[model samples]
Target: MANNTTASAASASTALKARIYKAPEKAEISGRSIFLAGSIEMGAAEDWQTVMTNRIAHLPITILNPRRPDWNNSWKQSASDPQFREQVEWELDQQERCDVIAMYFDPNTKAPISLLELGLFAQTGRMVVCCPDGFYRKGNVELVCERAKVPLVQNLDQLIDKVIEKLTEEKA
Candidate 1:
């Protein structure tokens, strides 16, 4: 009886919680997950990750957000840079593992990395992109999305709507 009680208590203590894991920080990922992959061009982009996380906090899922609060712009982009390499690797791993990838492109910023990610994952059928008007690469994004048959929207609100739809659709 004591052994049973102890095991139950331990399991409850370590039970998974709905949370957000920012860049370079990961965990033994469990349950439904969505990777927040989008425009984060050295703060040129808006803080969409926070908004997304807050909007979806009630869901039973983990949000893998790649916006690093302590990101140092001095770091080299090459794999030789430890921090940069780790952040890239973590984002890639989470994107691959996550059930869905929710991406956004802001018009005010030219997000090269976000463009690359969109290209890389467009055919995966796990991505939903929101590239609003005035974005530098809106045409390219739209054409690719059309060719790949990926879901594309015009704004953040639509992105949230689609994300919830996808997540709930999967659960059903």
Candidate 2:
């Protein structure tokens, strides 16, 4: 029993230290990075990105999460704004360079940016999408996934599992 408890504790500690690429100022490392693109709208208290990071922390990779915990939607949408430009540019570059892009559309929000990202990388053959039935444009996302052959999941758990599968396949 003590052995098992010690093993679990070690695992949890390692997971807690998992690298999360949230700011562009961080050093760019060479390794598989999973760019997490998803819904972030008003009143969204669920931090799916953190859940995902913990789930896959054992893997030797970085998780690029674009959702800021303190995001302000009212910020100007132009690139001229320093903060806006940094966030946008970092996400775009991370998406392009990442080994896999995992996108999820929370049923409660429209997730317009996620939709655009799905369109942008649907054909990359390196994307895992989760657009639950309740999303406003589930049909469109489904069609795109079908035509592009992107693996789609039904929920957050499935998304994490699929991502793990992809990472394992890449390693093998």
The digit string of per-residue lDDT tens for model 1 on 1-172 reads 0011211222344553356677777545656789999888865788887777666655667778888778999999999999889999999999889989999998989888889999899999989999999998899999999999999999999999999888778454
Whole-model Cα lDDT of every candidate shown, in order: 0.81, 0.76
Estimate the lDDT of model 1: 0.81
Q: How much lDDT does candidate 2 score?
A: 0.76
Name model 1 segments beyond 4 Å from true: 1-17
Q: Go through the candidates in order and give the C-alpha RMSD of each one to the true structure.
A: 7.6, 5.8
Q: How much is the lDDT of residue 42 in candidate 2?
A: 57
Backbone atom clashes (below 3 Å) for every candidate: 0, 0
Q: For residues 1-172, could you state the per-residue lDDT of candidate 2 as single tens digits?
A: 0011211333545653335666454535446768888886758625677678768766766677776645577778998888888888888888888888999889988888888889898888889999888888999999999999999899999999999888768454
What TM-score would you give candidate 1 relative to the actual structure? Answer: 0.87
